[model samples]
Target: MLFASDLDQTLIYSHRSLTPSSKADPILPVERLDNRDVSFMTQNALKLLQELSGQILFVPVTTRTILQYSRVNLQGYGICPRYAVTSNGGTVIQEGCEDKAWKEQVLAGNVNCADVRDLLSKFREISHPSWVLKESDKLADDLFYYCIVDREKMPYSELDDFALWAGKLRWTLSIQGRKLYLIPYHVSKKSAILYLQEKEGLSTLAAAGDSLLDLELLQQADAAFAPSHGELFLQYQMGVFTAKRINNQGIQFTRTSGIGAAEEILRHVLKMLD
Candidate 1:
């Protein structure tokens, strides 16, 4: 089976999302930035990931820019996922290098780049520098635009308005913590996985994530899961796509959230496929 997963919050997690433990040696750090550890998973979760890496094709699907994604060190854990969908599907990585032709196709054909650019400019014009970290704002390889924001200061109404504006422009807005994303409809994690499926003839697929960006991927997968602590979970409670969880098909919810949920989903996948 080919496993497509979101990195942050699903498998890897920042300290903020990690469960506070009284016992030491409970979790292992998996990602670093600026010589400091940032993302982690439970020790058991790390072991499961290593075993899963050996058992199947693993692909990390993320909204992170390639540079940011590269900061994650999976090499030591026997988890060398050569194929990664980065920039939220703006670029595909093969052995740590971008597949230029595929990237070009994604930019020119898949994403309506011109329309996205026009919309991005308008967002920039309206975004207040107080909340929108303008310096962190970047147009990701022309496929999407995103910025880190001061979430506490950013008004919810503004975000809701932006989401509507994005929809009108055939784009999607995703707010994962401080990182706010404006992505074109076509440049998506699900589309990227479908491209891989068509090329590699992958049949059985499993996926895990805890964000709106992952909804399409989850719905399309043979077996998919979401943690109890994400936008989708709230949506599910509000009767959005509740049948998946109710029917035990397509998508399901995990008992835990954050890194704890990471291990739970992996165990579920192994059990299902076995």
Candidate 2:
């Protein structure tokens, strides 16, 4: 089996970073080790991950920049996903290698290269706000599209405005963490999964995530898992309705109990497989 999981608040806690805050409560323990900040992970979940590492192909599907994502050392946890997909499917990496095919596909799909830049620039100018911060060049060697303002600087309302403006260009905006991304409608996590399918000849996959950007990926998977927080607020504010809403969002559980959630989902998956 091929398994893809998201990082950030899904697999990592906000406090585990060099900076800790109130948001760390539900997911991290108050007890601090000497100088090391700890994040929460269920023991059972970790055990399952260790087991899965041997029997299945594990992939990390996260919105983190390649740089930030690399900082995570999964090796110490006794798990290593040989194939990691990041930048919200903008790049697919071999655990310890570099490749550019993913970026190339993105460029070929564009009939008007300059058009994307122009649209993003215009959106910035028209909707720029004091709250909107840097609009970094999302372009990379093998990236399919660009992203806009970093999340911390972007206010919710302005992001909403940007999304509306993007609609005019037939583009889509997905907010993951503090980053607001501008991607082509045709470019998506599903497309990346399809590419993996072609290359690996995999027949089934399991995916996990916790934001609006993850919805398509979740829907495309043979089995899926969604964390208990984050973008669920936006989903509800938009009056979106789904069959289930656990923990006040899609799934509800203690953040500190991440392993428990992972185990629960995995057990269900294993049962289906059996």
Candidate 3:
């Protein structure tokens, strides 16, 4: 079996997610992000991940760049997952090293995509220097571009327009919290998962996430789930998204979020094992 999951805001959460800090148990910071911000996951969630890692292929799928992805401390008392799909599937890490074949495949597959440079140019045209935090601006190995935006100072209409413009160019744009990503249609978590699944000869897939980027991954999985508080959930309720696979039966969304959501999904996966 193959188990794929998104990281940020799915399995891992921010300090703000530790609800009612006065009453909640003390939490430990696992991921040290830039700007001194730290991300957390419950001890219960980590323990479950350790158990799951031993039972099946556990793949960390995310849009994070390699550098950012490495900062996450998923280490525990188990072997690290041999594969991670990073840069939104532009990079496939296997056994602690990138599988070069996958990188070449992604590049060649996106050969027809709009130039990454054009995305940078378009951002410059639409951005206000003061609103776009330059320190976080980065190009993911020349495959995609992302930067932290001051959302309060930025208008939603501008981002909406940019998304439409990028779509016309065969590129896709998505906003997650303060970070904005402009990625090509061909570079995807689903593509990487399919490639890895075939390579490993895995028969079943279970996936979970909470964003547009993860929708395809969930829909493609044999069994899938999402939280009730994200882009996916909003669209799901609106009938714009669907992932009730004929092969699987269960609760579609976790009862809570952050660590609660992670643990709920892990428990659900444990049941799927039977």
Q: What is the lDDT of every predicted structure here? A: 0.80, 0.61, 0.81
Ranking by lDDT: 3, 1, 2
Model 2 agreement with the true structure over 1-274: per-residue lDDT tens digits: 6777776555555443423443333333322334565555545556666776677777878766677567666677778777887767777788577447876786676653336767667766744545445555455433434444545555677667777877766678666555556776656666776687668888887777667777777766767676555674357456784624322333332242332445555555455456
Task: Name the regions of candidate 1 deviating beyond 4 angstroms.
Answer: 22-25, 110-116, 150-165, 240-250
Q: Model 2 off-target regions past 4 Å?
A: 16-40, 112-114, 127-129, 133-165, 176-178, 233-238, 241-260, 270-274
- Model 1 earns a TM-score of 0.88
Local accuracy of candidate 3 as per-residue lDDT tens digits, 1-274? 9999998778888777667751275455677756574888777777888888888999999988888899887774353888999998889999789899998888786767778787678867888777888778888867788889987888778778888888988898877677888889888999999999999999999998888888778878888877767677777779874555555553278877555788888888888887
- Ranking, TM-score, top scorer first: 1, 3, 2
By lDDT, the best candidate is 3
Quote each prediction's TM-score. 0.88, 0.72, 0.88
TM-score of 2: 0.72
* lDDT by residue (tens digit), candidate 1, 139-166: 8766777789988888788678877877
**Residue 49's C-alpha lDDT in candidate 3?**
85
